[model samples]
Target: MTEAATRRVPGAPCWVSLIVHGLSATQDFYSQLFGWEFRPGPEQLGPYVRALLHGKEVAGIGQLPPDRHLPIAWTTYFATKDADVTAEAIRSCGGTVAVGPIVAGSAGRMALASDPGGAVFGVWQAAEHLGTALAGTPGTPVWNELVTRETASVAKFYQAVFGFETEAVVSADFDYQTLHLRGRPVAALHGVGHGLPRDRGPHWMTYFQVADTDEAAARVTGLGGRVLHAPRDTPSGRLATVADPEGAVFTVVRPPED
Candidate 1:
């Protein structure tokens, strides 16, 4: 099983989505790398669509709408017991509250917030279900990692909101400080004392696992997705950056053999 699969809260990371600028091409590019199939569903909010990977409901991807002016990015949803409380903790912990504390039908509730370093994530309150009906296999969401500065402060922020415990990132000795909730690793923390990509703001990036990073990267190229960064090895294993034909950027991670 994937390290991410071992991190479930009986239904954690239940859902996630990649916010993009263009819907048509974004769908085509990701279908190649992750083998995801997105189809229009009952319109709930905006152009929301159901995302499936390997024939299982995994997540969602849709245009953020032009009025929002938000860049294309991936957002993850962590199953929470209470989104209202989670939203409050986010503000108290020096994070930004972007949206929610709103109930999403019977599926559950959600609150959108950002960490101290400006990486945005969501808190999900599971009702009849918890999170992703599927995860942690090849071409599925195996991890949600954050790359930013202020590892300690970021850890503190998440701890306050999600009740996660964190050790010193420096001690993890890995590229990022891993965080745990309910005795299971939920996400990672990356410090950025170094310079940014030509100087951009700090943000969160999601990594979906695949069987072969090189082959997936090649598929991304073939599907007209932009390769932002070539495959590289980290303490976590091989990873690469890719942007959909529509310019939505996300990563692909291939963990070391178990």
Candidate 2:
């Protein structure tokens, strides 16, 4: 079992949240899929719900502002010791700071930014809220990665902002790099080159682990989500890409049995 305390290493993906419409339906779908329970956040947070697994926070669900017509997405947040400094680093490094450095009640301060390639993500400076309490287990996020066409530029931008070191994974068909913080792998980047469908843009993808990929993919469809890619075995695991009823895309993986 993989476990980490509430505190996270800076530059690690310490929090994830879905921005979508219909909070009730979103809660229901995830509860059925992962057996997660919901807890209400501070009222000031505005329609935010915390997802708990066995009484520990695993993820969050928040409603998009009614006036904004943004597509539903899962935003992955990297841990930061100083939100203000991180926001400035992002802006100076060619990324756009879209929001925050604002207080999230007593939890911490947060800000959202879009990388030069247009992949949007968040940074969290923890106070009382230490972000995710459990991970590396079923139903909790296991990995987060950036998929874009501008590999070199994106690498430089992240290294400048977060001091991430890129280790290229030698592959013939794909250009992939692992983003490491001090020596541990925290996230990854994949260069799609000319392969991205015109309808899709660069974005951060969040991954959740399961015990059985085939079974989970079936359950997703039964529960009103769509499995975009059928389960396929990889060197690391058996995985599939899927979308929730609200059109947010993520991956589900069942690690190879020991």
lDDT of each: 0.71, 0.89
For residues 182-239, what per-residue lDDT tens digits would candidate 2 score against the true structure? 8988899999898764666899999999988888899899999999999999976999
The TM-scores of all predictions, comma-separated, are 0.87, 0.96
> What lDDT, from 0 to 1, does candidate 2 have?
0.89
Off by over 4 Å in 1: 1-12, 169-175
lDDT of 1 by residue, 65-140 (tens): 6778776667888776677777787888898888888766666677788877777777778775455666668767
Q: Worst 10-residue stretch by lDDT in candidate 1?
A: 2-11
Global local distance difference test of model 1: 0.71
Residue 6 lDDT (model 2): 70
